[model samples]
Target: MSLLHRIEHPRDALAWEGDMPTLGRYTAGIAGEKFFRAIQEHGQFLGTVCPICEIVYVPPRLYCEQCFEHLDEWIEISPIGWVHTFTLVHLDLDGNPLPEPLPLAFIQLDGADGGLVHFLDEIDPEQIFVGMPVEAVFKDPAERKGSILDIAYFRPV
Candidate 1:
């Protein structure tokens, strides 16, 4: 039997002399790209409103989930929103303790039926309450690249 070796770090694994098959490369499709671009370039929030149900989807959808209608109406939505719900996470993505607790929230933008799950900033975790009003803080126009991170985080209003 051969000894089993473990990869402690990605950088260390680079020393291996074998083919490393990789399989993960996720991407946000066309609708998401369009939404991100609007925010990244113009500092605007975009949503798609369904004509049939009048429901709006943020991160605008190509088609309505409810009525299955093709969504063609793209409307701008306010970045100001309320936190529908949230959680205080104390660990990092690697399950290690973070220096501080982070608030992850589901923010429901005004005038939109659906909400977005994103990080919250500039507030104490203890002070975080459901229905708390928040607003998006975007990166400088020159720094934006049409990514969700373009809006750094939502801060208490």
Candidate 2:
């Protein structure tokens, strides 16, 4: 089967409801706190790199999973990378199709060994490709909050 075929859209009102008691509130970790602060204060992108293993983790980290050691160093990551995978989201979980479609892609960030999943904007679905280059788009400095939304989306570079 194709990768697109494996993708499923939520088709019921229950899926869109946010009233579930099990839903958790947003809490910041030590590393994540630093990350958000940087976005809000400096408009910079920082990631954690294991000094021992050299694995770069975006959104930063308190420890290296591979070497099993505490990490304190931060590395700046490039906003550009290739799209490893992507999909066109046609519906908003309520089963209703959106007035306009959006594309979300898993971008393998440059300089990091891995990637992050985020929305891709300002491009048509037919224009997206598996290895297309993309750059992060940051919100206006004044409008930025300490959240991932500070980086509005990735756009073709």
Candidate 3:
């Protein structure tokens, strides 16, 4: 029998009905906190270098999957990269058409094995292409929060 079917008070399930209110909060934990802090405080981009396979992960990782070793080496990487791939989105998550199309891309930063996924700005969707060079644009230092959004967006270099 389902656990919910055996509840002592049927009112237990009703709390989930009809646009129930919710309180939600989250913490980014250690790895993420450090990564974003680098961006916010220093305007620097960072990555983790796997000592075993030598692959560098941007948005750094605490460990490596290939050799199962903990990654401890933090390296600074250039904010410049190429558009590895991209998509043009015309609709919002709710299926509503946006005022303008947004171009999003996976950018493989120079000197790193992994890449960052972010929105591409200052260009039309029809003009973006694979291998297009781009660079990060950061929010003003005073305006930054410790988050990936601290990068206002990536734009053609």
Candidate 1 residue 74 Cα shift, in angstroms, is 0.8
For each candidate in turn, the TM-score is 0.83, 0.82, 0.83
Weakest ten-residue segment in model 3 by summed lDDT:
11-20
Q: Candidate 1, clashing residue pairs?
A: none
Model-by-model lDDT, in order? 0.90, 0.86, 0.89
Q: Write candidate 3's Cα lDDT for 1-157 as tens digits.
A: 6876686777866656476588888776566678899999999898889877979988788878788788889989999999999998899999999999889999999999888899999987889999999999999999999888999889999
Q: Global CA lDDT of candidate 1, please?
A: 0.90
Error of 2 at 90 (Å): 0.9
Give the residue spans of candidate 2 off by over 4 A: 1-23
Candidate 2 — worst ten consecutive residues by lDDT sum? 6-15
lDDT of 1 by residue, 24-43 (tens): 87666767888988998899
| Candidate 3 overall lDDT versus native | 0.89
